[model samples]
Target: MSAFLAPIHSWLFNKVLLFQDIEMDLRNKYLEIYGEEAREIIEETKNYGELIDRTKSIEELIDLSNIHGWLQNKIQNGESRVAVILSIFIDKYGSDALKTAEDIFYNNGIKQGQMAKEKENPQNAKDIFSTLNNYILEGMPCDRVQKLIQADEHIVRWINTSCVHRGNFERANADINLFYKLRFLYLKGFVSSANEEYKFFETNNEDDYIYNIEKA
Candidate 1:
């Protein structure tokens, strides 16, 4: 059973589902705001990827013969869909769309963070970071998007080895810097709820991105 679809496979699938859920929530919000206009906005942004059948488990839905590629495709699909939606919204409605999207990401992050804290009882910065990773979509583990630089009981630091979302954003014609801004909101919300005494910060070090989680 482990060979066909391991725990990490299921873990990544759940992350994909989380992104889908967030995207749908953003879509529904637009639907309510724009009424019939949203249909066309969403339609114009279509074909980035297909949504999965929510009723089925990953084991039931995955292509067993090409498990890695299948999961990778879904991850890319999810990333592309998000970038397109955000891009389209910003182009059509400007700051209004951006504000709504920002709220959705931050609220979802807080929700995930609180759930992680309640379920895992994370005691320190490292524990909080581990639990947060379970919810955020950072591509497959093999991508090595982040590498741990240092860690102690009170602090855990990592450097971005690569970015998985950049290509999708570029393909969608979205502002990559805006994506990071929205993502920062999500992280801020997550850390605030995940642990009140801890904070998450992003810094630049000679063209590299550094992420730090430590006690406040």
Candidate 2:
């Protein structure tokens, strides 16, 4: 945190920015539907933290002396905002709002997948899995939110060692399962768009969810 930003710092920062971007998209849609009523929740979200200036590099905006804490705060702030916005809309609009949120996640995932393909040209399930991690904001790299269960030419399997979104969603009175479902839409979109041969899936595993990327 001393003006010595590593690749991981910028990586985490980018994921946070992506998360915020989705929040902004939700805000815009809220305004379109609820108009003035959306103002209250929109302002409430701003109270969490100032949005990051995405055009600028993380190096220019992050707190040099508290890099880890700063990135962690971004994740918390973005997740809380997302949870609040989606929860309110879900309460008001029910399945309709959920549909819009799903579309946002899925379409954004496709864009990210396409971008990752351009950069990495991922040729296998494991490659797609790695690229998915690059875009997913799971926690700090040290937190190790994901654990690889297996990997080979045909597939890659993993489980969540920890969840960084549950607390935020719970505090906002949102369903954590819904959040995971939406994220899976994003991942499904990502894998398909990243490589037509790859597909993504998730299933219940007692307390933790198991995720897979495999040949279609």
Candidate 3:
């Protein structure tokens, strides 16, 4: 009886250990595949929620302004891939990633401008603008940066004719006012440091935005 019981016990113990090992491997593989997908979903979902809230708050402004119908529709569409990328960065590196990236771009722009100022033959406005542009491009993926540049051109156009949007913006209580102010301040700082006045004007050509630099 003792011999029979010993064999039975040994078989049961080995099977239990094998089952545990299989379970552990399955858990690890599941995490390996699903973990990244889970994180992406979380960030995308959060960005969607934030964008929806922002759109809701600014709906009145959108309705009142001279903004293009396509732009209004786009904003209302709630399909901001930039927001998702930003959210991923924030999740992995913490919210401070935003400030850090901004500082990198801003400080480099200032440094380039200052270096130009110190030289007897300072860099021209076009060169300075290129430096600032490169700084921004360095911190983002190329495709995303291209999209940003296009959006920025639109924003510059809007601000150049700000009379169209100012009243609606003022009444809507939107945070875009901060962006409007910051653009002027940023350009002003570049102009001051580089010892140049860069003037942007609309043109009749296909690529309508052009800038002229003058001695300060």
Evaluated with lDDT, which candidate comes out highest? 2
Clashes of each: 0, 0, 0
Worst 10 residues of 1 by lDDT: 41-50
In model 2, which residue pairs have backbone atoms overlapping below 3 Å? Answer: none
Which ranking of candidates, highest lDDT first? 2, 1, 3
Model 3, position 165: C-alpha lDDT score: 28
lDDT of 1 at 10: 89
Candidate 1 per-residue lDDT, tens place, 142-173, comes to: 88788899888799998878788888788878
lDDT of 3: 0.35
| Candidate 2 deviant stretches above 4 angstroms | 1-3
Candidate 3 regions off by >4 Å? 1-112, 115-122, 136-174, 196-212
lDDT for 141 (candidate 3): 21
- Stretches of model 1 off by over 4 angstroms after superposition: 1-3
What's model 2's lDDT at 170? 86
